[model samples]
Target: MGENINFNIVLFEPEIPQNTGNIGRTCVLTNCKLHLIKPLGFSLDEKQVRRAGLDYWKDVDVEIHESFEELRKKYKDGVFYFCTTKGKKYHTDVKYNRGDFLVFGKESAGLPDEVRNSDPDRCIRVPMINTTDRSLNLSNTVAIIAYEALRQVEFPNMK
Candidate 1:
């Protein structure tokens, strides 16, 4: 993994432990930072989370924040792109850069209107087939957007 991590994946009020664990593993493999905003639905020590992350949990650079506001305050100058179903543009439409923050909302409800609307131009979403009423799984959604951004930057520090 790279010593200088360039991307961050932020989960706001994530509900599922398994999903978070999976995302954490992805972060570890990609050398990206994982920022989790409370309140999480499951304990960080949950067995399911460990199982989902397999043996990669400890390698993940995970940061826990009390709330979205706290995270925002910490990364005051960060370039954040909120991912939501209501976003006007597709995730692929954006030209991702290093040090960009990719934010995903809770499993049940996506990002709040206030957050999504804060910078409408920075909001993005994965396209879905109209036949389904459900959105993509949280872990899958994170992987999709993360990889796209990583791809845009030519998968830095990856063999």
Candidate 2:
């Protein structure tokens, strides 16, 4: 991705270390920033995390926040798009821009009501088949939304 273009991938209370590591690698590949909220399920030093990232974890731009409010305070001017199954629009519907914040919630429960309600118009979701599956995997969800945003921007700086 272009050095001038940047996006933020916010994970609120991610439960799995492997997923977080995988997402971290994705961020590194896409030139996006990774924001991890507090109360993560696994320690950052866990072997699973390192194994998933495969020596690239250090290269990933990762930021840890004590809470969502802290993250909001840091990026007060950011345009946040909360990814949830209850989103009113599909992921591709939004016109993504550089520096947009793509927020995802916990694996099992998804984003809390307060968060989803915070900015209802900004909520988005991936179009999934009508099945019993409650939602997609956390890492997969991030990749889908991230790539969609990248695609809309013509894959800037990506060869």
**Global lDDT for candidate 1?**
0.91
In candidate 2, where is summed lDDT lowest over 10 consecutive residues?
Answer: 1-10
Question: Candidate 2: which stretches are off by over 4 Å?
Answer: 1-5
**Which ranges in model 1 have alpha carbons more than 4 Å from their true place?**
1-3
Candidate 2 lDDT score at position 134: 76
Per-model TM-score versus the true fold: 0.95, 0.95
Error of 2 at 111 (Å): 0.4
lDDT of 2 by residue, 38-115 (tens): 999889999998888888899988889999999889788889999999998999999999889999999989999998
> How well does candidate 1 score on lDDT at residue 130?
72
Candidate 1 lDDT, 34-119, residue by residue in tens: 99998889999999888999999989899999988888898888889999988889999999888889999999988888878889
